[model samples]
Target: MPVESLPLFPLHAVLLPGAALGLRVFEPRYLDLVRECGRAGHGFGVCLIIDGEEVGAVASAAAFGTEAVIEDFNTGDDGLLTLQVRGRRRFHVHKVRVRDNGLQVADVSWCEADPVEPLQPEHGLLATLLHEVIDKVGGEHSKAPESHFDDAAWVGWRLAEMLPLENAQRQVLLQTGDPHQRLQQVLALLPE
Candidate 1:
């Protein structure tokens, strides 16, 4: 896999592959990130902040993250930059450095993407639960492709994002490589 240097956006939230994230950009550094990404037609990485705040200083972030591709953008009434982004792929941060402008840039290796695997019969519980969760949310996922509940990776990511799991737990699920294994991890976390 190729190692690429990517600008990191550390947030208090976790974004799994195929999940959606909304970010408000008021910091100049992140504003620069949006501009740079727009100009290059590139995406940035979103990692969970393990320490420090999202503003002023660079925060310590988890090594695993999802590449956030900008899907839409608009200026809020307050004049802040609002971004609608979707998680593309997962990456492992090998090393990180602080730029002069305080942006935390990481040299990351892209993880192999999940192969298409239909949901297993044993994992059908996850698919049904996922359907209930999305219905309760009133279908706010138009931006996400029509839910492919039969797809193992799709089912796992949708649940990972909707489940009331802690950021650390969510990060662990994101790092799981095999789609079926990831579904098993999610099942283990469910209440009996």
Candidate 2:
């Protein structure tokens, strides 16, 4: 498969497919990255920071990450850019290079989409919980017309996002391509 190059944004958070993430952009390199992505109508890659800080120096990032597209953009009173991004696809980094300005560019291969499966009866509680959370959040973050609650992949993704899992745990979940297996992992971590 041919590798696609992406601009990487390594942070302490994990972004799962179908989830939304909010970011405050201040650094010059990131501001340029956001602008370029917006101009080209392309999404950027987001990986969990394994070491170092989000600002200053190049941080170590997880191999697997998700592609994030800008959904909303605003300039804050402090002259920083506030962005709402939605996760679209999962990718695995094959190689990485840091630019002079501290931006990381990665050659990545996209992960295969999980096979569709209906939500099992045992996962009813998870669906209910997700529905309640979405209701509270509202707007585009809310449940879609197709009703993802019945989809095993969607249910697992939503649970993985809402769960109080560590960044490493969330990265594991994001890398997992099997919806059923992901749900089983989430179930194991869920409280009674």
Candidate 3:
């Protein structure tokens, strides 16, 4: 598999494919990263912080992550940048390098896209619950027009976004390339 070098942003949260995340930018390294991404018309990788904090110290990040593209940008009254990023694809980190400013650069391989399969009848409840959760979230965070609740890959990705799973659990789901397997894992974790 071919590997690509990507700038990494380790956070306390997991970014799933097809989900949107809003971040407040203040750290100088991150600010520069955002600018570079914008200038290059590219995205950065967001990995779950396995150890350490988002500030100061160089943190250990999960090997699996999603590439996030900037969807919108705004400047807060406090002079901080508020960015809205939409998750694109999953990647596996092979190597990492930390810059002097604490930014992590990763050598990553993109995961193959899962084949789409219609939602199984037994999983109807999961689709219903996902719609409810999206409704509760409201606004642009709600389901997209192309959202296919009937498709297994779509359902799994949406559930990964809405379910109240730990960041680690969500990371696992993101790393799962098989949609049906991902959904099965999620179903097993859901309340009886």
RMSD of each: 1.8, 1.8, 1.7
Ranking by TM-score: 1, 3, 2
Best by TM-score: 1
Error of 1 at 185 (Å): 1.0
lDDT of 3: 0.89
Q: 2 or 3, which is superior by TM-score? A: 3
- Compared with the true structure, all predictions reach lDDT values of 0.90, 0.90, 0.89
Q: Point out the higher-scoring one by lDDT: 1 or 2.
A: 1
Question: Model 3, stretches more than 4 Å misplaced?
Answer: 141-147
Please give, for residues 1-192, the per-residue lDDT of candidate 2 as tens digits. 779999999999999998889999999889989989988999999999999899999999999999999999999889889999999999999999999999999999999987778888887777888788778866664737556788999889987887678998898899888888888888888777
Worst window of 10 by summed lDDT in candidate 1: 138-147
Let me know the TM-score candidate 2 reaches against the reference structure. Answer: 0.92
Best model per lDDT: 1
* lDDT tens readout by residue for model 3, 61-164: 99999999999999989989999999998999999998887789999999998787888888888888888887887765464654487889988988888878
Sorted by lDDT (best first), the order is 1, 2, 3
Candidate 2 scores a C-alpha RMSD against the true structure in Å of: 1.8
